[model samples]
Target: MSYAANFERMGRGFDLAHAIAEADRCLLCHDAPCSKGCPAETDPGAFIRKLRFKNITGAIRTIKTNNILGGACGVLCPTPRLCEKECSARFQSLARPQGADRPIQIGKIQRFLIEHSWEQGSEVFDKPEPRPAKIAVVGSGPAGLSCAAELARDGYQVTVFEARPEPGGVLRYGVVSYRFDLQFLRREMEDIQALGVNFQCNSAIQGKESAERLLKNGYGAVFLAPGLWAAATLKPTPEDIEGLFSSVVYLAALRDGRLAEMARRIQGRTVAVIGGGSVAMDCIESAVKLGARDVYLIYRRSYRQMPAEPDERIEAQEAGVHFLLLNQPVDYVTTDHNRLQGVKLVRTRLGEPDDSGRRRPEPIAGSTWVLEADVVIEAIGNRAPEESPEWYPHVKVNGQKLIQADPASGKTSAAGIFAGGDIVRGPALVVQAVQDGKVAARAIKAYLDQ
Candidate 1:
């Protein structure tokens, strides 16, 4: 089935009347905990109040003031766990001696207002007097885009560089289309671009040469926001099998309209995805959407311990994907010279908590079993590329990977060089990346003034 068909089956978009009604349900609490809970500090209660008052433009303005990527976040942020989770209404309900009502559907209402404003061609930026400095943002993902937009609004000349032919980075390539449509992302990018932020597509900052070139090209400050691009290694020989793939590669293909190629290779077959993160859930859902008859998500931990967002896991389950919890793939079972027939997996049990405070998976002896499948997709995690530190050794970094920057300012060790997003925090939520970019933009502005 086509992507549109899948969305139709999944109920694409939200109901406008329902959203407005939900917005009216907000208690509009004082010092709203929802806003405080947001890493980006998006004032959910205030925006919802604006929506309730029919001040759509004001709501959009409030959101864009703090988060340029608010359009995307309105649709993609895990509000159930962040904003809505901390809603005072839920607390009030609990205190009522009986269940009163669910928390205000803040996320859906925010998405409705933002999407409606964009559809109505409402202006996204407030006019500002021109400033002196110019800043260059590498990677046009949430971080780069947010930085560029904020800097542009602050009257600074901002230019964004994206190695990929298109902007939006992982939002376009890594995120599943079912959850976030490309058209919405493109609209948001266009809105930011209209604010005088220039974007140079298919431009890569590979090494020191590129970084130096950007600096010499009249850019006052350079912000490196290149996200994690290297997928973590999977042990054993299964990764070398013809049908085995990484979630990054798999999702990129789907995003780039190469799903037909993937479909032809694994259509009408059973597929196995190893990992418990959101990426793994995306892989499983994508496989099913691409015509995999039986898709299994095998993870080494229990459902509670799975790194994936609970809603994502539930969505995957609703999409007919199977979960093999507490199981780790040991090796691939090969039948022919080039085809992967299945995976040899061992059941696992939770052991002592690891450094991250999550119980580690330990292999259960003699619990090995073979799960038949034609394709295997690994979705463990990803790391930042090595070229970043090599190009700018002065840039602070926690390890060879992970750009190290001030939590408040997003400033690196090098003067006039800032970093954020996945490059700094490793893989993280889109909203957090937006927060990083906004923080970096403010810091860049302050530094340039000096």
Candidate 2:
């Protein structure tokens, strides 16, 4: 099968009838626990109520008012971990017999509304008159876009500067195609632009005087949301080999139209992926769809201990990925020409819980073994946050390199400078980043008002 056909989306959005039915399932509690559970505060309960009454425009506005990328989050948000988990219907379902409990499909309803809004060419936000004070947002990721969109709707001149040629930061580059296609992404980008938010691609913000420089120039306030682009690997990694790539490189190649050729060259060859996070899951699926003879996910811990979402792990399993659990990669053997030939691994046993609350994988001595592989992809996680900008020297970051901003508001130690997203909270869900941006937008507008 062709790569695109192989990676066809395994999930579908709700149709109009399905969405209304799902919306009708909402308990419509006055307290609305689901909305309280939402990080972006999109108020799923309120939107569902509107949809139940057949007010689709109201539902769409409710979402767009809160989240700029409502459609994207509808598809990407881990609702089971967030809103759906707190669903009152699901909670009350415990009183019934087994196989009778299901949360209101808020995410799918949200996605349907967004697509519907596009078809009607409805105005999500009226274009506002430009204010005297302009805003500069670095990094056009979810956080930056949300911040920009919010500020633009409030009459501020918002210009987003992206280092990459295209916007959508991780959403455009790192996200898997099977789940989110670029067409939807482009539509969202256009919607943000409709709000009068300008995007300057290929304009990078240097670490030196990043925020201060913008403020001193024409910009009145600055918000930093540069995502963590650096991909991490094992501490003592093998020398650079030709057949090895980092998760960032591997995933970017998939979206850039280069993976098709790479897949053809590596067809029928063994591919090994390391780590146990969402990126690793994406790599495994891409490799499988790419037609690798064997795609092995080499995670050091047991399946139960994987950092990737439970649902994600199940999907990877369904995609025919071989799970080499309880195996820790020790080193890689390369051919005479420096191409990766195989990976050496040692058996691992679960030990005491570590900082992340998962049982640490302890390598067993005298149990090393080698597995032949033509390609190796490292998706362990991310490195420390990228270098801090000289503009905010007072900004403090935790040991993990995450910016120490107020959780309630994305305020930093530096005055007139706000921060959010992966830089503030490390790698997280798109909804969290959206919330971070929303929070920062409020604080930034408040700061500028002062």
Candidate 3:
């Protein structure tokens, strides 16, 4: 089945009655734990209360006021592990006789409100007076959108430049449709645009010359929010294989609804996915949906050490993807014609804790295994664009090639040049990017005011 067919089967939008019923369960706590749990401080209690009161518009406004990407967040945020996990209602339930862990369905309620607003064509925000300074925001992802929206609300003219044809960066291209629908993302983009943030699509900034041009074009400040787009270096392997791909390319194809092309590459094949993060889950699930007969996710560490959410791992398993933990691929084996036939994997064991606190993987001696698979998809990780530093040399960088900036202010080494999102933090959750944008916006406003 095609990607669209898959979603059609999954269904879209929530039932309003069910949503309100869930929303009504909220105790409307004065000191909302859900809000405290949220990195962006989204008031779940307030929004739920509004939804319970049948004030859909008010609920959306409440959410979008804090998170410009609120709609997408409603769909993709791991609320069950974040906000919902800490909900007072759940705690109250735990204290009852027939103790049930029941958190008010905050994310679903937020989605309902957002969907309602979309149906009614309700605007996200009202236009404000224009400020004197023009702010240039690079990359139209969540961080750039958030920064642009916040600055526009503060009455600064903001122009968001995107390298892709669409305004949303990763949200539009990198995320799978099952996680976040493109229509909702487009609506959010529209709302941002309504706030007076202009989008310039298909514009890539790769070097200092472009930076100088943007600076010369009357932009008082520049915020580089270009997310990590570069795929990590793959071990030298035979690409003459029938199906060898990167998770980013695979997910992008799925998002663009090119399922036939994607399926042609993996259908009826035994697939091996490298890495164990959300993207790996995406790859495994995509393989399942695209008709891959056998899908194996080979990670270098134990299941407990996986970076992906537990729920995601469960979902991938439910979809019939096999997990081969504590194994790392050493090389891809190929036939004489260079067609991929299998992989040579080395057994791994947990070593001492690394600097990141996770136990590092140590290769086990003489534990080599050869796994047969027609396809191998690498989802290890992503890095910043190679030319980023060359393009903007003034931008500070950490060891990981992530843009170095003050988390509190989003200011880079260069004056009037700030940055945020994955580029700054190195492959973080979307909520973090939104928070970074909010911080950068405030900092830009303060800087321009002087």
Candidate 4:
């Protein structure tokens, strides 16, 4: 299969007629459970109601004002577990069982409205008066972008610093363009830029002294949102071997325009990806698209315990990626030259529930095997920055190595500093990160005002 065929977005949201029809399906609830269920507080009920009344400008305004990344969230967030599930119209309009598209398709409708407003070239935001307070936001991911937009709307001078060569953080390089096109992400960043948020790419805040220096240089407050780009690697027997790739680096290669080279090597090869998250599914499916002879996803637990969104699983299955369940990899079966040949594995059985509330997989003794594979990608998960404490000693971290901050306010133990996004919440949905940024922006405003 060509990459172009796989690059197609799942859907192009909704058309004008379909959007209006879906909006009409909304019950216009007095209490707005759909809005309440949104992590970013985007107020889907109000926006859909406005859209239903043919108030396109009002609908887009409601979404963008509440959640800066409304467009991205509209496409990416798992509505089945979030806002759409809470819709009052689901029971009546959707006759399916167990979250089978029974809702009004709130997300698709929101995307349509936003895209329509943009296409019409209607001005949706009024420029705010400039304020003297300068705020430094680190990491140009969804959280930092959201915080910057909110602060700019409040008339604060906001500058977002990105460590990489370009901004957008995970949105720019971590995700596959098949699901999230870079052109769309660029348009959203242009919107943020219009809000007076300056982005300084290739600016790395090295240590605590550098951060303190920003405050000394008249920056009122610093918001840390450096996302979790560090991948948790597998400990192969003695040491790291060849043909091993982490999902972060693997997905990044595609987004960074290096997939052609990777595809050349992976063509007609056997590939295996380890984990049960969205990244794992993406790797496994991408291997298939890249022309791998055999692509397998090795998950220790059952399909029901997969942490990935339901759609990802379906997509992988449709793409013909094989699933190796109830199996745990013990070590790499390598050749004398140390190149990966296959993976030694062990069968597992469900034991007790682990900390994640999912049944743990216990290896069944004497049940060992080997799966042939030329390449392996590990997508187990990511870790919060381990150097965070060195960067800011006062910032506390929990047992999971994630930065600890007040849940509601996003304030850290350090004065004049706040944190959010993946750094604070670990790997989470974009909508949740946007919420963290919004909350932190509000708290920063309060601190500055006082």
Identify the runs in model 1 with alpha carbons over 4 angstroms from their true place: 1-4, 7-11, 95-100, 236-240
- What is each predicted model's overall lDDT from 0 to 1? 0.83, 0.86, 0.84, 0.86
| Candidate 1, run of 10 with poorest lDDT | 3-12
Candidate order by decreasing TM-score: 2, 4, 3, 1
Q: Estimate, for each residue in 212-235, the C-alpha lDDT of model 4 and write its tens digit.
A: 577778899999898888788768
Residue 35 deviation, candidate 3, in Å? Answer: 0.8
Tens-place lDDT per residue, model 3, 1-450, is 554577432246577889987887788888888888888767887888788888888888899899888878888788888799889888776567774658887877777788788788887677687778999999988899999999999789888888888888888898877667666777777888788888888888766657646788899999989898878745744344656777777788777768678778777889999999998998898788878889999999999889899999998889888899999889888888778888899999998999989999999999998999988888999998667777787667877778889989999898989999999888888888898999999999889889
Runs in model 4 with CA error above 4 Å? 8-10, 93-101, 236-240
lDDT of 3: 0.84
Residue range 405-426, candidate 2, lDDT tens digits: 9977898887777899998888
Question: Estimated TM-score per prediction?
Answer: 0.94, 0.95, 0.95, 0.95
Q: Candidate 1 residues 1-450, lDDT tens each?
A: 574366322234556788778877888788888888788877887888887888878888878777777767877888888888888888777667676677777777767777787778887666788887888999988999888888998788888889999999899888877778777787778878788888889988887657646767888999999998877757644356788898888889878878668888667999999998888888988888878889999999899988888888988899888899999888888866867888899999999999989999999999999999989998988888756677676776776478889989998888788888998988799999999998998899888988
Worst 10 residues of 2 by lDDT: 383-392
Q: Cα RMSD (Å) between model 1 and the true structure? A: 2.2
Q: Which candidate order results from sorting by lDDT in descending order?
A: 4, 2, 3, 1
The alpha-carbon deviation from the true structure for residue 296 of candidate 4, after best TM-score superposition, in angstroms, is 0.7
Q: Give the Cα error of residue 265 in candidate 4, in Å.
A: 2.2
- For candidate 4, the 10 contiguous residues with the lowest summed lDDT are 93-102
After superposition, the stretches of candidate 3 with alpha carbons farther than 4 Å from their true spots are 1-4, 7-10, 97-99, 236-242
